[model samples]
Target: MAHKVFISYKKEDLQFKNQLVSLFNQNKVDVIDKSLNDIIPSDNLDYVMQVLRRDYLSDSTVTIFLIGEHSSEREGNDFQGRPHQAFIKKELQATLFDRENNSRSGLLGVVLPNMYDKVYQGTSICSTCGGTHNIVAIDDSTVIKEFSANYYIKPHNKCAYTEDDRYAVLVKWDEFYSSPEVFIDQAFDKRKEPVANRVTVYPK
Candidate 1:
């Protein structure tokens, strides 16, 4: 069940990205790397997006977003005429877009080590369910919000969401690195599920 995967991450997380790539190679993982290596030299935002969608993301089955400390910061002004979101934002948008040539890809968020403590804050008693639940703190970026919002159709009470309720599966870097296939497979399976239809490719 080899899958073509596209990785979306901020420039600061290059080392983690490289480590993930190296891990893939070392494990002889059956995953195809379709991540962007060289920057596309263009001032036109639309052109850059077109190239990314058509070339890098068209065939990718899954998109793994590496969430770092500053991943939510807004940056990038490559588009000369109009204001635009960062490249990572655009990349996730493209990955979620369902076109004739490219269907929506399964989305996975990998929290980097730098933000591990912030993201995973141990367990807490759920006020609503009266059960212990993991306190996961994800960024409030529009891109992240949009995907997460659509994914949890039926939350496990007001306090938490079970893994089955999530459309975009999230994992810590270490957990993901330890067993990449399991997460990738989980993401890939989402594409065929009913939740796939709930995704808003371009959230306003």
Candidate 2:
């Protein structure tokens, strides 16, 4: 039997998400997206939670977050301010808690390769990040500096919830996305590596 993976992401990376879904499908991995359900715009947070909870506990064995530059950006409008991160946090917390009690699998975090360096400040896009599992960039300078600066930040800290969350971070796209084999190896066990004083890109 094949493994079913569920993807939870912000709407900004619709194109990339489709491409990724295609890639995973080609590899014979069963992938599903939460947004496939015709969720109405007027649905309240509680309704959203109900939907997420159902999918989170379905046949899906792992939840992968398709992270982009603006994955954690919080936006507000006149009528109601959508708390994307906070709501996602709640969903994840519920899923994890349920999985822990019911003996289901946990989640995975896969980030866009070099998203932070490539995105601009005013980009009107949102990203999706799993609780922690993430991909790193090979040549992003800010990622190296920030990861070296601090191991972890509070959930509400700017570093953790920035428009571009991969700043000065530990993970690099080059290192993680070198090949499918590398991705597989890290997917099973993601460890925090020591930040090299000088970042270097190796020729593949």
Clashes of each: 0, 12
Whole-model alpha-carbon lDDT for candidate 1:
0.72
Worst lDDT run of 10 residues, candidate 2, spans 195-204
Q: List all candidate RMSDs to the true structure.
A: 3.4, 12.2
The TM-score between candidate 1 and the true structure equals 0.82
* lDDT against true structure, model 2: 0.42
Off by over 4 Å in 1: 30-39, 73-85, 141-158
Writing each residue's lDDT as its tens digit, candidate 1 over 84-166 gives: 33566677787788878678889988888778787778999877778999877654642355445545554345567766667
Candidate 2 clash total?
Answer: 12
Provide TM-scores for the models.
0.82, 0.51
Off by over 4 Å in 2: 36-42, 73-79, 99-104, 114-204
